[model samples]
Target: MNKYIIYLIALVSGVLGVFAFSPFDYWGLAYVSLLGLIFVAKTSKKSTALFASFLWSMGFFCFGVNWLNVSIYQFGGASLGVSYFLVGLLSAYLALYPVLFTYLVQRFNVQSAVIFSVIWTFTEFLRGWLFTGFPWLQLGYTQIDSPFSGIAPIFGVTGLTFFTVWASASIFNGVAALFNGKNPKIALFNAVLLAGVGGLSAYAQRIDFVKPVQNEPLRVTLLQGNIEQNLKWDPDYLYSTLEIYQKLIAQHLGKSDLIILPESALPTLENALVPFFERLDRAGQAADTEIVIGTVYQDVHSDKLFNSMVSVGNPNFPYRLETLNRYSKRHLVPFGEYVPLETLLRPLNSVFNLPMSAFQSGAVAQPPFMAKARVFAPAICYEIIFGELVRQNLKNDTDYLLTISNDAWFGNSIGPWQHLQMARMRALELGKPLIRATNTGISVFIGAKGEILAQAPQFVETALTYDIAPMKGKTPYSVLGDMPLYGLSLLFLMLRGMMAFMRRRMNLSQKP
Candidate 1:
């Protein structure tokens, strides 16, 4: 096949993966996408395969995250061309991960499924970690609703990613070998391994890893303020935004044991909003309710500002100006939350001057919020997308996972749905029920099994109330967060190195 044609096919394969994720959820396309990349790596020259992989990932990211343009162009006061250029630039940079993976596979002539997955795991990990990380659109997220989701509790998302790649390679190698009337033994082994993973997943799904804390569920209300992104940070409209959420909280105060608010539900700095929060604290105390709400926190002691969430009421936990009863977001979005190289970039564009974009991260070891007799580990906005970060923050007694986001930035785009999907995966991985409250919109109560119990519609101002049971016990993933996968990956890496060295030796000796 022509190399350009191969690259196009590779690119199309990646584009297909977009439909496999959120709002579409055709999970099988992930396998198909990997198969196409595998074909490119196997059939094309090393250089061509590496470039083809880059094109493939380019197709995946450009279409998958195009919603970024909505925020950059519409909200950030940037021109359409600049928005497109920024998104394209980010997509192009991310595509490099797949290119490195292809280079390793082609250079080493890796055939073992384990070795292939090892390379894949490292590349994907590096992509998410290097330079504050952008772990969006990982392969494991597509399997959240699939039977393979069962693997999450054992090995987490990276494990599911390994299984996906392993199974795809098994299908490709086994079917091809069988058709060629060769390597029957290898084909049988691949077939059995593929079937084994499926069987294990189905079996694991039937077994309950955690149980509800009590027979009676906790009455929880998730508030979706549906505040417009443009007006959220406006000083003129801050009170209007606060009033909307205040009304929502008032309506649910006595009725629900816990009322959750979206990220930045109140757009003012925490220090500036003390009196307002004091009223909320007093109201919740009077009603015997606990409220978890997101806001911007600027410390009085320092110039530091944190994107934070705090709980009001439940005498044990009071609304405070400090980090007490608070979970400040750790994983801050690069340009969206805080501008990097501010001296160089801030003056160049309005995108860098986005309202409330200059914020610092909180401490890494902060305790989870205690609400309504259940412990909750919170992830604010972009934090939930990082599986390892979420895992690291989990505690032994964590009952429900909490993430509050403001997705209006990507208005009416698949971005919100995709964000919700990743949150579900976190719920699945930890074997814990989840409370996801979002601004404009997608407020949801996700079950411990990663099922959506209730959801508020997008762009709607609404509150969803449900009696969510707190879960007890730790998922294997909680006990061992991706360490097993990394161990296996390291072993595979050493094996591949030895194999490659032997192959070179054999080639040099046979040259005579």
Candidate 2:
């Protein structure tokens, strides 16, 4: 085969892998994608393998996260040239991870499927946390709707990545062996192993990791205001935005036990909305309902602003201040929420000059939102992507998980759908119902098992009403977190290293 043709095949495989994720959801394609990687690396020289993998990763990130350019050019007011340049730079940087993976495998001559899977998973873990982490388009996220998703509660997303890569490599090696008319027994063993893994995944779907807590089912209404990012924070549109949400809340006042508005649903600060909150308090007192509104809150003394979720008129407090039951966003997006080096980057473009871009992060150990005699953990927008961070906020008595986002920044891109899918994975991992409210749609209620119970249309002004039974007990992933999976990956690496050492010693001794 032509060398450039092979590289093009690798790139195409990576592009096809994107279909395995949201919107397309052709998950089985992921196997074929990884199989291409395995075949290229096995057949090519070290340098060729490294370059091929880099090409594949470049294609993967370029296509998958192309939505980044949409936000940068459309909303951030960057020039088309600057937006594409930045996107290209990001794709190149992300591609380096695969470069490193391929380089290590070639250098070490790692042929074991177990070792390859471990290295792949460990690299993913590193990518998630390094440089404040971009962690988008993780391989495991593609399996959210696949049979493999059943193991998410046990091993989390990283574990699913490990198993997925392992299965892909195993099948590729086995097929190659059979085609060469050698090692028929090895091919048969690989077939059986693949079957066993699939069988286990299917079986895992039936296992109940958590039970429903015996409480009155909560009737929740998630509101999508469908606000445009350009006008969301414009001072002239503030009154209309507030009125839109206020009227939406009023319509669901008596019908819902809890009403949720998307993040920054109100364009103004909490201090500016005192009268509106007071009016809502009176209405809530009459309706016996609780409202969770997403708005900015300013600290009077510190002069700091927070992207916050404030509960108004909880049955417990009829006329308390809106700040009484507020949960501020702890994890703020690096460039979006607050520029890294504001002193240097502030003057670069309108993106850094975004309104309210310098908001303060809430405390990591802050209290959950209280409503309807239950505890609700709240994550604002980008914070939902961090599994461990979200797990840290979960409590023994926490009844529901709530995430609010204004994805209008992503426009009609795949970014919103991918974000929604991650939220569902979190719900499945925790064995709790998740209420997700978003601006410009994909607002949904996800069940404990990661099923989308109800969803609103994208880019639409609508509200979804659903009854969610709060769950008690914790899933394995919730209890142990990612520690067990990380430990297993480390163990595999150690074992492979020892085996490699033994093989070297045997070869040296046999040289005599």
Candidate 3:
């Protein structure tokens, strides 16, 4: 096959990955995309493989996260060209992960799907770890609806990633040989291997790693204000914003066990809003409702700001005005939460100087907040995407996964859909119900089994109410996280190297 044709196919394959994710959710495309990548990677030359990998990732991120330009241009005050450039630059930066994976695998002369998958998983971890981590649109996320998803409870998203690559490899090897009318034994072996893998994965879906702890259900309300991004940060619109949420909560007051507000729902510093929160506390206390409000908090001593979630009322932990029981956002976004290299970037454009863009991270190991005597693990905005962060916050009795976001920035794009899908996976992976409340809609109640109980429309001012049972058990993922996947990947690599070395030695000895 011609190399340029291969490159074109690689780019298209990457874009195909976009459909494999939320909204479109053609999950089988993920395997097809990987198959194209594996076919292109069957090259003897290193540059060809590396270039194809980069093109593959470029198509994936550019199309997958193009919604980013909406915020940069429409809200962040950047010019249209600049916004597109910025989005491309970010996509190009992410593309380096696949490029690096290709380089290493090619360098080591280990050109097999199993080896590539191992290296691929490690590079993904590096991408998420280095520079505050952006684990969005990862290949594993595409498999939430596929049979591969059953493996997530065992090893999280990375487990699905490993198998996606391996399965694609098996398909290519088996199908290609059959087409070429060559290597009957090899094709037959892979056919049987794929059958076993599929059978076991389907069986794994029946296993319940987590169990119910209580019979009683907790009534919950998620508030979506749908306030436009411009007015949300304006001090003039403060009372109006508060009133919108106040009315939403008032409707569900006595009928709910918990009420959740979107991230930064108040749009003001916590100190300045004490009287307002106090009023909310009184209402929640009277109604027997626990209100979890996303608000900004400032440290009086240092004047540093933090994005935080406070327990307002009706909780096992009593509400305090001065020092509220809260979960401050720990995983701050690189540009969204805080600008990197502020001096140079801030002067470049108005986009860099967005309101409350420089909030400090909260303390690590912050305990889960309580609502109606049930423990809830909290993740704010971008923090929900990191599986490790969510895993660490879980307690033995944590009953729910609570993630709050202000996704108005993405506007009416696929970004919110992808974000919501990930939130569902977190619930499925841990066997805990999820309460996701977001500004500009997508508020949802997700069951412990990863099923959506209810969801609000995008860009709509609304609320969702569900009587969700607080789950009590943990999934295997909850017990042991990505450590198993990491160990297994390295083990496979080492065994592959040993087997390859033995083969070469045996051939050399047999030479006459």
Clashes of each: 0, 0, 0
- Between candidates 1 and 3, the one scoring higher on TM-score is 3
lDDT of 3 at 301: 79
lDDT of candidate 2 over 249-286, digit per residue (tens): 88999989888889988888888778888889778868
> Can you write out model 1's per-residue Cα lDDT over 18-95, one digit (the tens) per residue?
988999999999999999988888779987898899889999999999999999999999999999999999999999
In model 1, where do residues sit more than 4 Å from their true spots?
179-181, 316-318, 496-512
Task: Please write out the lDDT profile of model 3 over residues 166-215, one tens digit for every residue.
Answer: 77877887777788899788778877877787788788889877766566
Model 2 compared with the native: what TM-score? 0.97
The TM-score values for the models, in the order shown, are: 0.96, 0.97, 0.96
Query: Model 3 TM-score?
Result: 0.96
Query: Model 1 has how many clashing residue pairs?
Result: 0
- The collision pairs in model 3 are none
In lDDT terms, how accurate is model 3? 0.85
Q: Give candidate 3 misplaced runs (Cα > 4 Å).
A: 179-181, 315-318
